[model samples]
Target: MNSIPASRRWMYDRMYTGRRGLKESFVHGVEKFITIACQQQSYVNEGKLRCPCAKCQSTKIDGVHTVRLHLFKYGFMSNYYIWTDHGEEMANVDNNLIGASSIGINATECETSNSMHDMVCDALRQHGAFDILENSNVEEPPNEEAQRFYNLLSEANCPLYEGSSESKLSMCVRLLACKSNWNVPDECVDFITKMLLDVTPVNRCLPKNYYDAKRLVSKLGLSARRIDCCVQGCMLFYDNDYGKNDGALLQCKFCHMPRYHDRNTGSSTKKLVPVKTMFYLPIIPRLQRLFASVQTAGHMCWHYQNRSTSGVLRHPSDGEAWKHFDRVHPDFAADPRNVRLGLCSDGFNPYIQSTTPPYSCWPVIVTPYNLPPEMCMTKPFMFLTCLIPGPRNPKAAIDVYLEPLIDDLKKLWIGVQTYDISKKQNFMMKATLMWTINDFPAYGMLSGWGTQGGITDKRRLYGVGKVTSPLTDVDTLINVSSGRATEESEKIIQLEEQVRKSREEARQSREQNKRLQCQFQSLFNVVLPLLPSDTQHILQQQVDQQSHDNHDDQQPPPTGHYGDDY
Candidate 1:
């Protein structure tokens, strides 16, 4: 396959109409989605449907399905979906999935439109969909054990960089500490909190004092009231050793850096609140993480750049956003084609949600790379103007994700720490699934399709690549005309390297996708109805005792194993 030009590639990749019957094509899409879901979620056993739950040894079906709908773009097209047991999950069906298809969003289907506004409106009207997002606002109150863990964390004699809101790191530290020392309930919480938080010794408190304090807070469980924050904030926590001595400034992991508002002084700290770790708090659903990453880039980075009302510095990408920012300085980029932001602030407000420009209000961030400041910050802009399709959020029907479903990563890590040998493996498998579910949104977001980061600016700089084709076939990839570009051995070598890498990724994607289909085909076609009762009993006999089989236990799931590691 020969490489295509950028414009043609964009047009070819996103604009197409399936030649097959619209209904049939739509059906295939939905079926494939369901097949993919199953492939990713579970495995089949000897005539039994076993979820990877450590204690819940029952085989029960979690009712979920994916549906497809059709729409018009001056031409007929189809939409694929994932439905859930909850009716609300399907309430705003069309708008939720296909809305972007109208606005030039080249999904896995590669659908696009010329007029962004028209495409979005068409999708909104046709799909009648709502965002089926899980709100972190709701939670089942934690029990005594879970409460003990929170109290331990609350009394960390020294608080380093901690998000004011409930974030995953806060919870994980508490959960794992509780599990590791669950037996000495009094002292367990303190020991774990100390290790997890890594507070300064000068902050003051004894191990026994740590244990004693928990006794007071133990009465209060880790309920919604206690779980004040979602722990999925933008701040990245780092050890004081790194943050202070190593010139690592304390900053919000998600937002980059946020100065803390002191409780007593009411003054902001030049120092950032640092934490022990900075990797994402796995609690953020994968989709949300993707959106947050991009959104933060726009909100924090772009918003603070040098501002000028004349036009964006140098050549910020968004002409409109650039024009809006030309209030104070010249918009300059190292490349004249590039754009930079100008700065101006309205001082801090107590109710401020983020450091992002005023127009952004949505919780999730859509653009991962630096954004050309949005809109002319003058006059007025619509909420819709700032609204962007961010990477997906983390919350979902646990069924869509693989088993040992973790509502909060803190809880999941606890399960990991205390899991018996046999259970540990099971927990790891579940974690793998969680991580896999999370990885997709990140990858999908990073593919540069979600936002206009890698979008080529034709007029400013036509670094256009090409693939010549018409809207004749939508089922295939961009087709390039083959003339002996193969004559260039160096280019040929590069092409070979590219193909090798692409194929490996595709194979991994294919196999990961195949697992869901295979699991379902094997389940409904073989395991569910075929095995006689006597056979199931005999199979159970092979492992009557739940002990580890002296094998090199760290194997991937027997099935559905395309992981982040690969």
Candidate 2:
């Protein structure tokens, strides 16, 4: 199959009057196109093919006949003459032929433009922001937010150089991905990017350094906010109250700890840097972003849409906790797009296997349970909400660090206006924190539970140098002091009685076994004398073997299965 270049005017030009439909030549061209597409891919035999009509734009999969009808109605998408999505390879086409057909523009330039355009469109489509570029019904100009998004999209489409396939946004994104995957240092990335720019064409559009690349990418609306925190984790210097003074508080209100390190006596011009700081990634914008893409927007409803009916606990949605939540908040549950989240936080040594001093950093991760089981816990979906810097565990003071996250949760509970890309409409999207994930000590820190003592009762407090009986419950002690038989004391008495009964039964069984053994020995001695010499010898051997087996069973088990005898 041959690719018809976009410069072939007859393929796209309308050549018919109102009464008659498309010209016979165009119809013949469509028929030949369909025949070649079907012949190139085996999947088209399954009764469907990717429609390349301008309306569908190869995004919609439809029956072969329907695709043909769409082409007849709307014509093929512009510059889709390559048919790369179906089977035609761009490498097979002659660059000189494409260049000659398309006026002054050469094949490389055209290909680069197409590639950048497709890349930008695909990204916007996934983010559910494609409508901003595609929609033509707006009478008024785009708002500030929409206009900003459009500018970013334009930058993403701008090529790095005149014939280069890489765009400014693409280069920045690839560089960032490489930096993250390889743990590359900022200085190294700056050096490499600088070297590339120096060697490349003078008209290059690439970012100057690592920071420049990061700045360009940060405009995508997923940037983190850094907030100074107290060294003792007492409070954060955030919110509007601190805005006027620019968070210039000198010390923590609770602990009276200095907010910043002591300044050098000689260096009076040194900046006052915070003793500790945490990075907080707001949850609302992230949750809204999830519903922007059609793929993820549909998935965000999987918990409700794919709710199990067989009464099996396959997913969190199948559990009673989720159902009870729905019963309590019907309004939130009514909208499948409303998110349900699980928060998880843990402290780990970031500098593993190092000789450096011991340090712990806590990362608070938020997972949306709206996705299916397979996707809900994946790294991509696990949103890192905060990074708590530490030289030691926050312990009970962890709540002080969680204040910002709690504020975000409260706002989410009230609801936020979000665009649902799958539905193509705006709706109030609310979210609730269903539960928390943490280890025992972390749980104690988060919930104020005394995990160090009282296994059955979490509320019981035990302090240093305090004397208490391990077996006595708080209620039992109080009842004993009052000389009253309380429920706890009665329960303890019942347990003791049950233990006594079990011991008595065990003793009776042991006595019965001894009596039976003695009777068997007496009977064996009586029968031994009446037996013949050979029969007596065999009977004695059997009795001896049985005794030996019984002795072995009473002894401790061997440490290993494969012993020297075996």
Candidate 3:
């Protein structure tokens, strides 16, 4: 801390104005502005003399023309840590602070001959970095696809920078949402890439894996939708009871192999469509909302004659959709079938199955499990729906601009086109449902399960554990320590261990019966079929009769495997 000593008071007086304002002369820490302003006044009064302040006349403190803003948004943390969106270097680092990185910020003082606010805001905006709070133009009339993509990107609030913990999570989501992995129409992809690259870059990207994962996914043709549910035996998670577990679609890689969803069901139909099913479990609300958005978009698109890849055209800036795509390929511009996308109120998930190859799930959140208590009481499996990104990393190309994707929900709401319930509604599946509202703070250590009235504590404004929403600027990222899950897992292990002792006694008879059975044949064959046909038939009949008797008895299965899948 720099201070003006008693001996230096004379120097300070000569250096500063010592302005004769008897009302107030408050001196707080680092009052550089007052110092400079006073110097300018003194210089003007003293026969236009040069301002002789120690800062201007001597090398007392570090000599650098740096601009710093007192970000009240950071609360107490700002006392030590400086926050910046620009890619600049930090000369100050203290043990108590998480220092700043220069990405998306102005490190070099811009040479603009304007006020500090104008200079700063202009520099930031020119580089695609603007005070998000100052402008709500994100919803301006974007051309067709531009509007669609923005709606998808707006699935949830995006946080950036290091001021609040949620900022980190938002940054993570934004970096992960790039469109390059989606094979988006080139114009849309190009436009989104330009915006993202202008804001976020790789190594310094919000989620460090943002770049690597996109690259790997692009190479492997993978999407978060690849995993369905882990608890459903890697099968499609049908209407699970509200409290049952759900596995990630991507984790269940083989779930789409035909053998998973359609192995049985007794029907000889060549194909059966999978209806949208909700398993019994609480998930991030944002996922449900995103699904809702997609479903709305699909509805609007279904009605458009020449557009299938459409969303709400909130903004008119969507340069001619087909024309833009045509720039992607000259011939594509003239192709009649290469129609532009159309997004309405009820729309589609960009990634829906076509019964063709490369089937991938619509991008949604990927969870790390066991969030803290403040998020909610149910230690439920928590995950987010990852939104698709629009373009390249900021590091890849700072000035690139891609075309826009639309937001169908807004279009439907504005009555861009009249709605009709009779219009080819897919009764079984609103497959593109984009989003739902669920709270799963990335850093909420105890954010789920086993809290008071978690069953009854589901209210929003009055919820016991609930807090303010992001757009309100009254939120903070929940601080989640990484080792929390390990602690929870140990507790689960102890509980399971105790249950086994009691269950073992109850399971003895079934275990004994199972030990008496043997493999009927080798891996490839069932020897039970080798017997005479009539004999086999009689055995089958007896088996059926015994099965009926067991059902009448209502006995517990002899073992966990007694009624296992054939």
Candidate 4:
């Protein structure tokens, strides 16, 4: 009745190869014993198995004696120990139940043993194998849902001999994500590829190498169109009108900065330049891709129905700006498919600290705020809209680079013919640039609002006549039609102030003229009439003289005195 030490108990726990096998043996033995007992007189009516042991025969005691008792005491306890690695008594039921060389209460020679017990013991040894064979022989009906999943696996066309391309792609993508998330080196991709190809089955077709794998990944990702930009960060190669005119270009139209360095050109006929390329990923296709999946499309619409409006402003949607936007453009806000996007940009040095004179790069990112707040701000949910390649920040000229984006946004506002994946049809897809998120410097660059003013001044400066007209009348509207504030809001405020000041000055000037007229009338009617005709003539002559002096001197009278006329 003593227990084994904790350290040594693991050996007892792992005595069997598989715990499942042990469980099966115990189950089959009990079932076979019941089958044998039922063959005898009224087993179910009596509610006990007729044990043929000498002890049971003499005492008339009958039940599932060996099977239930041994299984409950040994099998269950052994399974616990197998999991927890702690038990007092080791389970030795397998050898005992199999009728091996062990002394027991019902010990007897096989030749003289009860046939039922022998058969029960034999069944335990070959327990689950028979059931497995039976299941394998039975065929299950095919299912439609299962067929779709099977089709996904079949898309890769890898044979059973080799691993499926779907699985390999999944693994590769996971590895790449991990590498990026952990800031691991690019070599990790090569290492992973080599390890997989070497250790995995030979027939499998992976990427030829890491570069090929990268290309495959790019193909699977959002499509990017590269546009050359001025090295001075002056402008993008494609303008708002560049799409209309296909004239050849060599330099920036505005700054006349060369697109490429002179040394980059080859002596041969081909001209080469140090490519300052900006990779722009169109938002419409990305938005369409999100809707292509049923689950994601459903999640994207969650903000409309499930969003909380506590007015504490947990998300941008809860703010007054968003409300104003909705109010201004009720038609655009009517469709949940009309996405609201938040833009973000920040500059960083791609090289490590060890590198001297680091180069700066700015990546523009956009988040679809149409998703719920929890999912909307997550890194994976954010989309890379463009790369603003730079040694220096684009500053106020970020708009020049944003011409393509603004143009596309205008197109979206006008209604781009887009394929609605969920509806399985083509329709107009419109989206709005709800707001931008950035630091102070980036704010000035993106919004064109300088940092020379206080917070209230900035607000008033931005919120007045400078406000962009919410109509797509021009290419420079920059989502003004989406109810976003613009430079015109400031101009409108300034104009109103100018009109008020002009009106107040005119009113004051008229009041001053009325007082002067009243004074002149009093002098002529009361004082001048009392004088004689000659005196009047003399006074008139003096008044005329004073008027002439005033006109010549351009001077007003002293504080309390009129001229000699008084």
Tens digit of per-residue lDDT, candidate 4, span 1-566: 02333432332232246544444444554455446445533445556542323222211224666535544344332112211111111122221221111111122332332243332222221111112222333233223332332243333323224322133444444555666668877787778778777876762656545676556445544568888877777666674543543124788776787776676334664566645888888876677655543224445555565446565777667776766777777898787777787888888988787856867788888888876555677654588878877777777667756766776677777776554322334456688787677786776667665444332253434532233222223332343322345545454455556755766776676667657756875777688888799999998887778657745553332432111121
Say which prediction, candidate 3 or candidate 4, comes out ahead on lDDT.
4
| Ten-residue stretch with the least lDDT total in model 3 | 396-405
Name model 2 segments beyond 4 Å from true.
1-122, 127-129, 132-147, 162-164, 240-246, 268-270, 455-566
258 in model 1: Cα distance from truth in Å? 26
- 1-566 per-residue lDDT for model 1 (tens digits): 02222211221222336843344443444444335335422322222221111121111223222011211111222221213211123233433232222222232222222233222222222111111112211123233332333344334312222312222322433453445555446455666557745654432332334434434333323221111111233322222221223124434444454334334465564653322221211222221211121111122223234344675454343344323223222422221212121211111223456764443111211111232223322211111111111122322211112111122222322222211110111111011110011133332222211212222222112111322211111111111212232234334445545756776776686566558656754664456346787876765555343223512232333433122121
Tens-place lDDT digits, model 3, residues 1-566? 12223221222222125744221122222243324433432224432221113222110111212211211111111111221112111222231221111111131221221233222222222122112211323222333433333343333223343322233323333334434345455455445545655676432433334454245223311122322222222343322223334332323445443323543667777663432321221222222222122111222222122232456442221224323333544542332211122111111234456764442222222322111112111212133322222221111111111000112222221223121111211111111111123333211211222223322222211222333222111111221212344355444445545756656764785565444432322321365578888987887788668657744554553544211231
Model 4 has an lDDT value of 0.52
Please report the candidate that would top lDDT against the real structure. 2
The lDDT for every candidate, in the order shown, is: 0.28, 0.66, 0.28, 0.52
lDDT value, residue 127 of candidate 2: 28
- TM-score: model 4 vs. ground truth: 0.53
TM-score of each: 0.19, 0.59, 0.19, 0.53
Q: Candidate 3: global Cα-lDDT?
A: 0.28
**Candidate 2 on 1-566: residue-level lDDT in tens?**
13345444455754487636688878888887788768743344566676778766664556778899988888876655455456554345555433222333233433443343354444533422343223323233433453466457655666565534456877787788779879999999999898988888753578899999899888978779989988888888777422334266788878889888888889867798788999999988788777764435666877765678898898888876677667666887888888888878899999876789999999999999987776677666789998989889988777767767776776677777776644556677888877667886775665554556433231222111122322111111111111122334445445545756766776676677668878999999988999899999998999899878865554433333221231
